[model samples]
Every structure is written in structure tokens, then in C-alpha cells.
Target: MDEQLMLVENLDMCFSTGKGNITALHNLSFDVKKGEFLAIVGPSGCGKSTLINILAGILRPTGGKVVLDGEEVREISPKMGMVFQKYAAFPWMTVRQNISYGPRIARKPKSEIEKITNHYSSMVGLEAYEHLYPKELSGGMSKRVDIARAYANQPEVLLMDEPFGALDDITKKQMQTELLNIWGQENKTVIFITHDLEEAIFLADRILVLRRPKEDQNSLNFIQPVPFSRPREPELRTCGEFVRLKAELSEVMLK
Candidate 1:
């Protein structure tokens, strides 16, 4: 079997509010296999975002480690790329420029930058939009740019935080199909964090659940596995197997 691409072990994340320190995740652990599509879901304030941040090395964990490949990284590794919940595209830059921003910042060879940006623009279906600015684009269009920018870096591990949160239902579903196409084409390890169970079920090979921080009582701890088949169809949602799996996961989510 292929090796795991990322591993989060005994994770503990806490935030310091004016009130005091609030523990967000307690002893959370999981592994993401290479080329696998993983999703993390939980109630609000369950530290799911924090966990993603830690894995991206954007935020430091109070305890535990995010090991990629065979080693732990002290800073954000260049091999990891991210798409935030909100669109993080640069309004001043054209679509191509935004997608090429990372390579530009790294001072890559001009020839290489052009080659990569052109390829990514076509890959994300934004070739025509390359010359356009973000403000000229729709909300969904901005996200497409964001995804293109991240993938243009050719990162082996991708971290997406509710990338479809802002789109309308129709646009959101379209984006999902687009993302699956991209994932299928690249076959990289992907970790998607979201609250939408249906979305998770459709896209994830495995699902991780982070228990809510319960001040009133101790939090539940565990990651749930999703055994649905790939190239999931709409009818899968109505199938007896899918129905029972979703109902079970929903029970855990409501807890």
C-alpha cells in the first residue's frame, strides 16, 4: 500500500480569549493516505479550522505534531497549499497574475512561471478570465481563481477550508463537480474541512470528526470513517447503504 501523506497525532489546540484560555481540540489524531480525499466535519467551534491551520503550519498546536511524509515541519512547508473559506484572491491582480503570485514571490524563472500559470488557468477552466480582475468576477468565479492559484503551486497536499461556503446551491454543486474533476486529474492527498455532511459524503474517502469543546461536560473524541464508493452518483444518497451510513454519521454530528 502507498504511504500516508499527512498525520496529526495527539492534537491539542487552545485559544486565549480575554475570559481565559479555551481548549478547542483535545488529543485529536488521524492520518491521511496519499492520493486520498479526506474530510473533517464537526459542530461549530470544534477546532476543526484550528486543526487545518496547524496542519498547514499557519497556527502552532499547543501539543502534538503534524507530520508530512516522514518528518515534522517547523514552518509552513512549500509542499502544502491552501484555499481559505473566504475567497483570498488579490483584487488588484488579474486571474493569471493571482494564480502566478506564489511563483512570482519565489522569484521563479519567467519562462517557468508563464508555463505553470498557463497550464493552471486551463486546468481550472479560467483561461478566458486570466486577464480579468477579481472585482469583475462573480463570487463563484473568485473561488475558481483561488483554487487555481493554490493548485498552480503543484503542492502534493492540499488543504481546503469550506471552499464552497459562499456559493449559491447551483453554483456550489457545479464547483463540487469541478473540484472532483481536478482531484481526479491530480490524485493528490486532499483534506477538506466543512460542516455540510452531504458534501462530505459525496467527496470524502474518509471523514474525521472533531468533538466540540464542551465546558459543561467532557467532549466526545474520535474520527469517523466513510466507506462510500468513488465517483459517487446522486442516487447514492438514496441508496440503503448510503442512507444508513449518513444516518449514523448524523447521529454522531448531533451529539
Candidate 2:
């Protein structure tokens, strides 16, 4: 597989508050290829979102660099679609309207917008709900809408910051399975952040583990080549290899 994206060399992040200077990320580095699912896991405030924010161009790093398709990340665009922990769907808009927003903002023609919206709504299994408003949707329905809108824009990279974090366990699992199905069809490069070990193991082609320091420092422990096969089977979670990998990550994360 060719490398479509990478964070080459050392990457750093810092912030200055009223008290003093703070460094959120230190020497962060990783590489991802096309159609790969990469998951980043760490303790809360260990700079998971900080790293993501930097990648999204929402927050520029204080030092180092990021290389996307051999270029620096200068701005955010539909080329990268972000899904947050909360369903950031517009409650006032119908599902179709919400999905059409991105294409419209890009000044796409009405004919093109309709084509993409209908395609994405069906892709996310939300075709029947396109006319429904957010208030009429269930927890699962709302999340599907958010996902539909994100993918409709035809992003090359999908950045999900614990999208299932707000869902019930059962619903979360169902969404995970649904996501894999959608991904199989779309094949976009994915970077997903999750605190759940099982979630990382289940979804990632490889996992990047972030470390938190007792004295308030940040570091990384890279463990690649994780054997998470595509089209995952529910029974795989019970397999010894799967449990062992999950256990190994737990041991490192605890300190």
C-alpha cells in the first residue's frame, strides 16, 4: 500500500495560560496509508484531542510539522471529515438538508448536491429518514445522520473523535459494525480516537498508544501491525489473540 498520509519527523504542541507554559504533545509521529484505520488511545488529557485538533488545522502545533499528501496541513476542508463525540447535527434541518450543507457551502450545483445527498443518505442507511428532523430521530438515528453528512462531502480522510462515546454499549457496538460496512464500501483513510481498548482493537488496522506522565509530560509508545482483519467477526473478540493484544495495551496504559 502506498503512503497517502503521514506525520513525519517530531511533532510538538504547546499552550500558554495565565499561570505558565504548557506542552500538550511531545515528539508525536506516525504514518498512515490509504484505506487504513488508525486509532489513537490515551488517558484523558494526554493530548489525544490536542493531536487531533492539530491535524484538523483547528489548533496549530507550536513546533514540528504535519505532512498530508506530501504537503503541510494549512487549513481544514471537506477532504477531511470530522465526527465528534457528540452528534453535531443541526436539529432544525431535516436529514437531507444537513447532508446537503457541505456541498452547498462548496457552491456545488443543486443537481450535484441532490446526487451526493441521496447517495450518502443511502450509504449510511438513512434514506428513509432524510425527511425527518433531528428531534424525530433516535440516538442511533442521530448518529447515522451525522455520519451521513460527514461522508457526503467525499472526504479523503475521516477523523472520528470517539463518535460512539455518547451511545449506549449496545448501540455503540452496532454502530461500529455499521461503520465497518460503510468503510468497506467507501475505503477512506480513517483516524479514530477512542479510550476503549476493545474499540481500538476491533476497528484499527494498527493502534498508536499515547502515554501520560505523572509529572505532566506527554510521550508515545508505538505498537503497530495489530491484526484486526477487515469485516470483523463478533466472535473475534473472544479469541485469545484479540484479548491478549487488549491486555498488552492495558498494561502499558496503566503506568
Candidate 3:
């Protein structure tokens, strides 16, 4: 088994709203292995987005802490990268500029920034569109820019919150394939947030399910493992085993 890369222990989050204190997560704990692709799924109001934000260090939990590679994540760190559901590219910047933004902010050498830009733009098949601004690109192309930018940052882990949730079905499928190809080549640990069970099963090594908190109930539903082999193709979606797993997860999701 891969060594553990992140530890979430006894996490708890509460909000002070106009109504009063409301808990979002309660005593949630899990471990993500190094280079593992872990998908998180749950219905609306289940705190999937909140968990992603906590992992990205964008929010501080009311209790517990996230330990990444042995150190606690107290605030936003350079070691983590995120891709949001909407296209996160800057409208004013061209593809090359957007991809190089992180390295530039870090004050990397000009040559290194240029190299990083070229490599990631090419990786996302955006070399031809490198000079185009986000406004001129298609939705899928814009998303490619977002992915390339996040990867070029060279973060230890990638936290994606429904990055493909806004694309049309066809484009979403294409991006999913491209994402898998990138993951295969890079071997970076990923924590993906999605409501789609099919998408979760298709891309993740393991699925962590959460439930809406009610009263004193915990937020965790269960964690399911994906046993499929790698280099998986779209045809796998039609196979008996894949369909069975999807059905099982659907049952769990609807409960």
C-alpha cells in the first residue's frame, strides 16, 4: 500500500449563523495515501465543499487539524493547489501568462517560468492557444488552462472541487479523460470533490462519502474503494463490474 500522505483526525466545523451554531462536520477522520486519487461525494449540504476548503487551508475548522506530510496546515500554503468548479483563469491574461502566474509570483527565474509555462500548456494540449485570452477560448479550453495553471504550481497535492461540474456532458467526458492522462503521468495525490457517483468511481482510487449532519449524527457515510485497473478507458463504463459499482454507490447515495 502507498504510504499515508495526509491525515484528517477528529475534524469538526461549526458556523455561527443568525439562527445559532450549526455543525457542518463532526469527528470526521480519514487518511489519503501518497499519490492516491481520492474522490469525495455526497449530496447537497453534506459539507463536501467545506472539507475541500479545509484541506486547501482556505478555512479553519472549529476543531481538529489537517496534517499534510507531517506538518499541520494552519493557513494557505504553497504546497497545495486548487481548481474550482468554474473556470478560474484570469480574463486579462493569455494562456501562457496564466500558466506561468504561479511561478512568476514565486519569483522563479525567467527561464524556469518560461519552461514551466511551455511544459504545462503543452501537457494540456493548449500550445496552439497559448496566445489567446480566456474570453476567446471555449469552456473546455478555459478549463484546460485552469488545470495547467494549477499543475504548473508544483504543489504536493491537488484539491479539486467539482472542476468539471460546469462543462457539457461531452466536454466533461473529454476533460475527464485528459485529467486521467495527466494523473497517470504526474502521480500527484488528488482530493476530488463531486456529487456524481459515476464520475467519482471513474476517476478515484477510493471514494469518501459524507452525509448531511443531523442533530448528533456524524457526517461520515462510508468510504468505498475502487478496484479497477489503471489506464482505464471509456469502455470500462459499460463493463459489468463498473456498472455494478456505480449502482451500489447510487443506492448508498440515495439512502
Q: Which candidate is the best by lDDT?
A: 3
Q: Please, what is the TM-score per model?
A: 0.91, 0.93, 0.97
Q: Please report, as a residue range, the 10-residue window in candidate 1 with the lowest summed lDDT.
A: 214-223
Decide which is better by TM-score, 1 or 2. Answer: 2
Clashing pairs in 1: none
List clash counts for every candidate, in order: 0, 0, 0
Error of 2 at 115 (Å): 2.0
Candidate 3 wrongly placed segments (more than 4 Å): none
Candidate 2 backbone collisions, by pair: none
Candidate 1, residue 104: Cα displacement in angstroms equals 2.6
Candidate 1, position 179, lDDT: 91
Which segments of candidate 1 are over 4 A away from where they belong?
A: 213-220
lDDT of 2 by residue, 26-86 (tens): 8877777888888889877788888888888788888888777777886786677988788
Q: For model 3, how does the per-residue alpha-carbon lDDT over 31-90 read when each residue is reduced to its tens digit?
A: 999999999999888888789889989899999999999999988887888898888999
Clashes of 3: 0
